[model samples]
Target: MNEFLIKSGIAKGEGNWYSRLTSSLYERIVWQKLNNPLGYIALALPSLLIAYIVSKMGFAIGVVILALIIGLPLTFAAMFYLKFGISLIIVLSFFLLGVKRFVGDVQLGLLMDFLIAVMIFGLIVRQVQERDWSFANNPISKIILVWVIYNLLQGGNPSAESFLAWVYTVRSFAGIMAMYFLLVYAIRSEKDIYFLIKVWIGLTLLGTIWGYVQEHIGFLPFEMAWIMATPERYALLFQAGTFRKFSFFSDPLVYGILLAFTSLLCFVLATGPFSKPKKIFLLAAGMFMMVGMLYSGTRAAFILPVAGLLFYGILTLKKQVIIAMFFAALVLGVVANVPSSNPNIVRLQSAFNPTEDASYKVRMRNQAFIRPFIYTHPLGGGLGSVGEWGKKFSPWSPLANFPPDSGFVRIAVEGGWLGLLIYSALLYTVFHVGIKNYLLLKNPKLKVVSLGMLLVLFSLTLANYPQEAIGQYPISLLFFVAIAILNLSVKFDRKPELLHA
Candidate 1:
């Protein structure tokens, strides 16, 4: 911590690079020593111990396999999170939290959130230490600041019966917004953008692999137990020889929606102006996610890539390609929906023919019962008024018992039409920013990224109509990360200059 030792410790003038890096003070600096094999061993020793503790034994086959699966990435993230903090948290937020009681029913979401909080807290402490107070000045930062305030104010919602529900639901809002700010703060260059995209693809590929295993191989005992814990959920998943795979996610529906959006993202990345190897990898990743999407049995999730690419075709404005894509999609749609005994296809077909779907009819009936109340309570019933959080924390509320099948419906029920309008405006503003940046920026990579982002946002918006894709674990984290990337990619000029790195 000595300033003179830090500044005069290493020389920048022409010298032997090896000697410069291996200076006495540099050797004393633990972080600098981490560049060597000795430091790697030092770090790995502790990590091995932690993994052993997590597995409850040092070298059991299951435990070893699990440790090998996650330990490398966990250690990598730990070593580099401070430097590449936003990207690390965004990736880990989805993959780690979806572990689904890996620690004997102890949820990892809170643990992940705590880690993120500590990362941000360190950033805050650094800013304070350096007397630099200029990190959160961007337009995106302001928007997120407003959102944090809005969600915090929701605790005052009169209809929120239990403080616990408010706490439970509002944390997602707060956490996602915090992630948004962290991204706005951390992404300082094109390299950071590339790093984020790389990480996104890697996480998508990993999730797809886990989803594939759940579909084809098997599930962990706790995962199956979670399904069997609820009779209705189990029945729905096991219907007619179809076992919808939830994988590491909390539910199959959420899993499908996540994969559905990632399919669009990877598909776009594949077709983008990236390298051939990356493009091929992305194409494979897209196929994995697409397959996972199909097996998820969340019929509503199918529209995401279809809708995203349709918008993408319009953006391209290529008459032939547009025409071909539209017709191809139509043909594929017809084929996928062909009257077959395949339960997956039948479930998908029901999305197109909702009237024949009993669940759809029941949802409509449920909507009729709640529409009048939403109309009257323009603001909303309150946060946590419906859904799992509602049942747990606000069971006394009428909306608590009633199921709001769609994301928009849940928002409308909780915050009323007013809340819906605000949320929609927030989402549209994001799309508008991405589009505006795409049109204005002349950079080819930026254009590809921006256009892809516009489509991704569009896809998520459409998916929200059916699945409450946002405001949930993994999905919400991924959503905000995407938003952050798109926002960061923009070429903003209103400010004279950025205040901090």
Candidate 2:
């Protein structure tokens, strides 16, 4: 079994520590040999001194200071060696960001930006040190790079109310693009791809459990306080529903859309060439996430999951999956219409019947209001002109007060019709390429992973028509990660899953 594990690269060679040197600089310089009193004393002097100093300071402050002094460098080192450290930080920010926002003014996304900046610095240093300078300088990266440059140009626009606003918008949007390229350039093999997919879905599952608990049971004190604080937002809930399971995302809509995507992906993966136990686990997780998604009361997101499932079937060239998916949907519909149907069915039915929906009416009005400005100012009001970004940054701007209502409209308000076209073109380009590659890629596993990502992207895009899905945390991070994975998958024809060293 040890031999098998070693062959599989699961077991690694190690130093049986304490006696046999793990070969640290201190091990040779101070230790000289295990339990040598003089060497031990020399090694212990700095730590012992720090402990004394800590005893003088309060324990908490001293520990914090010590962590900052020591832990930061260690974290940065891990970011380089593990290569997924930045990705994990980005993921964690997604998981905790909404909760952080509930607390106060310290922007959680800014922390993500800070970590990425450090990651970029460390990545540059590592690449230079190793003299290994290969990058995924493909069309997608180039397009994203150009888009970043375009956002940078927004910083100099005369219309921008606050320089900080422009800076934040450029950094937020362009940073997501940078993240795409970073993941693209960093991903080495199928192993990395699998690790990323698992982590992404693992977080989704965790979020589903949280959201389910929030609805079926109750929220934590902080969450309840935040929910109570915003009485006005209750009207904003889908159909003015009493409770919506937002989980760790920015809102119920975002959470529901993400759950829809992840739920579909889990179900698809369950049917793959996996062990029976793994398949069963995936199936159960998918169902649990689905229940959480239903609790979100996000009618707009409901339709997209079906679209994703259909895309999955088409992409995989599995007619049976399509037939089964339709059958499942039919059964769900029948069950939904039963005499004792779930209240969720009534809420979701409103998705297809939105004529009287208050939110839908408001959205229509918003679209009408934004159209004239979009047509007149074809270039745009600027990046932060409308939506939450607008209110926080350009509160004085008239456009800032009015909601943009849709991601598509928000793009139009910020970047103009031309900008929306360009953005849409970029997305379609990736989608087309992913579809083409799904058919062309020789490796079935690569095909499955990349295709699943494309479907998720597709679902998110559809969901974005009603809400800004991509720019939000976790979604943005995960979306770009998928794009990067798809970009890297293009290389499979030339090289297999193995790393180049």
Candidate 3:
């Protein structure tokens, strides 16, 4: 019976009759035209006519028509090609919120949610067709599942101030996390990994260049308008007699921390068995990123690379690594001590002297005040009881106004001490998996990539303590991708020949 169904094209798979019908129509209508020069003229005439008509209608109508003409097919293509979807997620993370400067207060995050959902649906379709889910059955994936489950269960917490807040927060916490499985499933080859890394580094270089422009030249008119839209935002961004450059990210903290961690990845990758020109490029990019971090004026960003390198050095336990660490430390020490009037340098120095900073002291006080509540409630005030959701949905609640400055603190406040413990275990498992893979991998290239990934993970983990490093837009997405890549590195080690291929 099964064989008969398969042969008859009645099976519930990609080779079914419905799929064949769609494929035939798509080929005849789209592919043939796209592939043939004569077909191009046939298609372009109608498209040009529609474009002319849309232009006559009005600007907004024309824009909508243009978007539909482009976006619909691209969306369908992304759904079909999970790699393209994943790549879109990565690219958008860098510039999605930045779009607010041009478009005004649109709910762009919903678009991200839609993209992730599409990717997950694509994964499901692939799994159904292939009958294989083993790629996503790794330790990192399991822990992410556990974390998502915990966050989902938060909606039922009786102490939760608003179910709507849970609805909002869980979209990010549980919904966005599904990307981890999608990424793990999609990244099946070494080439795919390298392509994604190139995308990441290329975007980072652009961000750094924009940041340099902002520092030396100035904010473009639209960016200035966006900055001045809110007085609080203006005050926060404009510090120490100059505006802190955020590049393409939402804020300086996100921009600076991203650069700090990715620069560590760059430097680590340069140490791989690659060609001299590639190594030089990696080193140059890493230096550019570090310089960009300085321009961000985010004190939390300053310590991350140092800590990441120290972790890497200890893990390697090589004489040369020790020597390198010594020189890096000496440079940092001189920079910290040889005080300059430059605000960027002063901010850098303050990162090392956290106790002396007014903001640091305030954060400490807030944590102390919030600690007793965490101790009292096993599940704390519940998810979304603090931070942006709290302010939006439960403005009257005391916790609503509370600033859980650190990611850990936010977790503790929302999920309580028990939740914090679970979150911590997840972090520990990621590190354990990454370190185990790095130590066990035999291929030199795989080892280098795995080590670079692990160091970036370590840096983000540490940064989460001082800033909400892993919870923001691109950073959060990148954090999961890094873990997926860490697990993937080990998988690639089994097929070392593929590295060259």
All candidates' lDDT scores? Answer: 0.72, 0.74, 0.86
List the candidates ranked by lDDT, beginning with the highest: 3, 2, 1
Q: Per-residue alpha-carbon lDDT of model 3 for 113-220, expressed as tens digits?
A: 887887777777877889998886877778778888888899999889899999998887765688888888888788888888889889888889999999999998
Candidate 2 residue pairs in clash (backbone atoms < 3 Å): none
Better model by TM-score, 1 or 3?
3
Candidate 3 — worst ten consecutive residues by lDDT sum? 5-14
**lDDT (tens digit, per residue) of candidate 1 on 184-290:** 66666666667777777677667768878987788878777777887897897886587997777667887888888877777777766778997887788788788
TM-scores for every predicted model = 0.80, 0.84, 0.90
Runs in model 2 deviating more than 4 A are 1-71, 98-103, 127-134, 234-241, 335-342, 497-501
Which regions of candidate 1 fall more than 4 Å away from where they truly are?
1-83, 129-140, 492-501
Error of 1 at 129 (Å): 5.8
Q: Which pairs clash in model 3?
A: none
User: RMSD of model 2, in Å?
Assistant: 6.5
Candidate with the greatest TM-score versus the true structure: 3
Tens digit of per-residue lDDT, candidate 2, span 300-395? 777877788777777666778878888968976775455534567777777766787887998998888778888977667787877667789778
Q: Number of backbone collisions per candidate, in order? A: 3, 0, 0
Can you list the residue pairs that collide in candidate 1? 379-415, 380-415, 380-416
